[model samples]
Target: MTELTVKKREAVGKKVKAIRRQEMVPGVLYGQKQKNEPVAVDKSAFEKAFLAAGETGVINLKIEGADKTVPVMIYALDRDPLTDKITHVDFYRVDLSQAVVAEVPLVFIGQSEAVKNEGGILVTSLKSLEMKSLPGNMPKRIEVDIAGLKTFDDVIYISDLTVPKGVEILNEPETAVASVKPPRTEKEIEAAKEGPAEEPAVEEAAVPADEEKNGGQQPAAEGTERPSEEKKADA
Candidate 1:
């Protein structure tokens, strides 16, 4: 478990900006049975703890002046669009005895024979898996072994995944997680390189019926001065 210490925050609204300028991040902690508490943490410290615990791993959050540390998980984050800096965060207090659902990132490991020997492309359909487990039993990430993908026809599905005894995957059992795709043929590769077939050259704009009746000259488009207006301007 990762441990992070934060101070109770008094700043709110525009005053919170001052805390951020001091290299602190403002956040709130809340849960089913817990009171919403505003806190501030050192930006660098929060980053390190987040990297270690992610969203699934349990974190021991200590609040200044509090008697006991609270077990929690990062629930959400807000970032500055231009700088991509963390602006605010939400922490969900967790009960060790209760079960919770969380999405665990999937990490692909091992080489596929189809990709290495048969020139097939490895395609993955899932990037994460939703799982239910006690906070203490939650895994930071799930490893997916791709070595079994021996051919283009071979696929790994949710039902095939192995996890800890207390953890239950919530996704449909038949969902395909990974597979090997047949490599593109030479002709197909060339066509892709040439880009989509030149969109059939837009047929020349059809001559308007009114223009056809008035001879070859196209009528002035709407919003533009007509020949008569131009003649009047010249006069």
Candidate 2:
């Protein structure tokens, strides 16, 4: 990656606004051996760098009045929320020989058989990774292979990545990066559309109506003669 240098800035506040009006972004740079310097860069140039190298690329920053190149990273950017126009930027000082930690985006490549052929969803847990590397050795982005995913249980972990040389991933080795999950099938959709399941009806207990109507009626004693027999003898 090459460096980009901006001219030294002289204006502030309203002057900065005027610079933006002229399609320029006001910026500042600070380094270990260098003092805080105000600079202004062509908006188009900075945009191109961001578009091509992303935020993690090692940039060669050429600042006005400095004969040598300063290794730097795009540390901060302020932009209009609605217009998405660059308002201001801050560049951080970086040493080329020393390793620096940066967050790099994760790019998943290839179509998963589980999602495309077997009707599954691709679940991605980690969208980016933290890595430490020297400016010149920084990678554009980490590429993860998902072409072999075959089932909901299929997953890719940080340990499975073949990281490029001179870069070390800062994430835990067991972290899940991507996975193939079973999609909601037609049956599941129909079940959802049907709403809650119906509960089975309970049967009511039956009461003996005859026992209730003949409240205290009693049966004849086992060894005693019936009252009808006694009545017949008397007659």
Error of 2 at 90 (Å): 1.8
TM-score, every prediction? 0.81, 0.76
Q: Encode model 2's per-residue lDDT on 19-129: one tens digit a residue.
A: 888888999998667789889999999898777666787678887787888778887889899998888988888888888888888998998989888888889999899
Candidate topping lDDT: 1
Segments of candidate 2 deviating more than 4 angstroms: 190-235
Candidate 1 local lDDT, 9-104, one digit each (tens): 999999999999999999999997768999999999999999998988889999998889999999899999999999999999988999999999
Clashing pairs in 2: 3-60, 4-60, 5-62
lDDT of each: 0.93, 0.84
Top TM-score hit: 1
**lDDT of model number 1:** 0.93
Candidate 1 wrongly placed segments (more than 4 Å): 198-235
